[model samples]
Target: MNFPIIHTNFWDAVIAIPIIMIITQLTKLIYHTPSKFVPTIALFFGLFISIFISHRHDLLAGVLMGWFYGYAAIGNYAALKTAIKSYRNANK
Candidate 1:
């Protein structure tokens, strides 16, 4: 099986994941998305961005990177929330 050469550029690291997270949060806020569905929405946004925008020429690369982008966003959100909650509790 020939794997596509996936190049991780500035867009992937410094842009796509954060954009996906922001869009997911906006979707949650605008449509009142339930917390349970937020990750899935993030995944969809990741896939859309990766497949259509970032990794447009390679389907395999797009799917793989899309999963990474989605999961990374999800993890980042969870970690940030936990840190903030801990900080608040510590302050209080």
Candidate 2:
């Protein structure tokens, strides 16, 4: 299987992941998404952005990068939340 030549541009570096995170959070806040399904919702948003907007020219690349974007955002959110909680506990 030949891999698509995916180019990582400014959008991928600075935009896509945060956009996915923001959209996912907004969806949670607006629709009251359950915590258990939040990651899946992020994944859907990531796939939609990657497939329809960012990597439209390459289907394989889009799907692959979409997963990364989704998981990366999820991880980032988790890490940030943990850090804040730790800080609050320490302060208390």
Candidate 3:
């Protein structure tokens, strides 16, 4: 199997991931989906964006980068929750 070329750049971390995360949250809000499905939805959306928008001709690269996009959002949310909890505890 041939591997597709993928470049990891600043946009992936700073722009794409955050955008994907926001989209995921918006989707959750619009659909009224359960909180547990957020990560899964984000992952599917990532794959869709990568395959259809970013790397149309490069399926492998799209899948790989899509995984990153999804996971980054998940990690971001987790970190935010942790920080909020820490702040609340410190203040109280």
Candidate 4:
């Protein structure tokens, strides 16, 4: 079995942290949800779209993926807000 080699280089860490922070910010802005969930949901959406693009290898598919990713993220944010409101009301 071939295992992927992981590197722990300083340069890699420097580049990776900013990229992660940017993604977290973007997800929070686009989704308009809490910052806490942004990273998790953004990574999930990014991974799904990335995999789809890699397998399909189509430009149009990539564009569609971007659109769907945004739509899904926004929808998720709305759903989250609604659920929280419902829970609060129920508890009160």
lDDT (C-alpha) at residue 80 in model 2: 90
**Tens-digit lDDT string for candidate 2 (1-92):** 77789876865847988888899999999999899999999889888888888889988889988888899899999999999999999998
Question: Per-residue CA lDDT of candidate 4, range 1-92, in tens?
Answer: 64423323455334433444456567678779776666466555544553354324654544444444544555555687799999999999
Worst lDDT run of 10 residues, candidate 3, spans: 4-13
Q: For each of the candidates, give the backbone clash count.
A: 0, 0, 0, 0
What tens-digit string does per-residue lDDT give for candidate 3 at 3-65?
766866776568777888899889888999999989898888788877777767888888898
Query: Distance from true position, residue 88, model 3, in Å?
Result: 1.3
Q: Would you list the C-alpha lDDT of every candidate in the order shown?
A: 0.90, 0.89, 0.83, 0.52
By lDDT, highest first, what's the ranking? 1, 2, 3, 4
Give the TM-score comparing model 3 with the true structure, all chains together.
0.86
TM-score for each model? 0.94, 0.94, 0.86, 0.42
Against the true structure, candidate 1 reaches a TM-score of 0.94
Clashes of 4: 0
Best by lDDT: 1
Evaluate residue 81 in candidate 3 and report its C-alpha lDDT on the 0 to 100 scale. Answer: 89
Q: What is candidate 4's TM-score against the reference?
A: 0.42
> Which ten contiguous residues of candidate 1 have the minimum total lDDT?
8-17
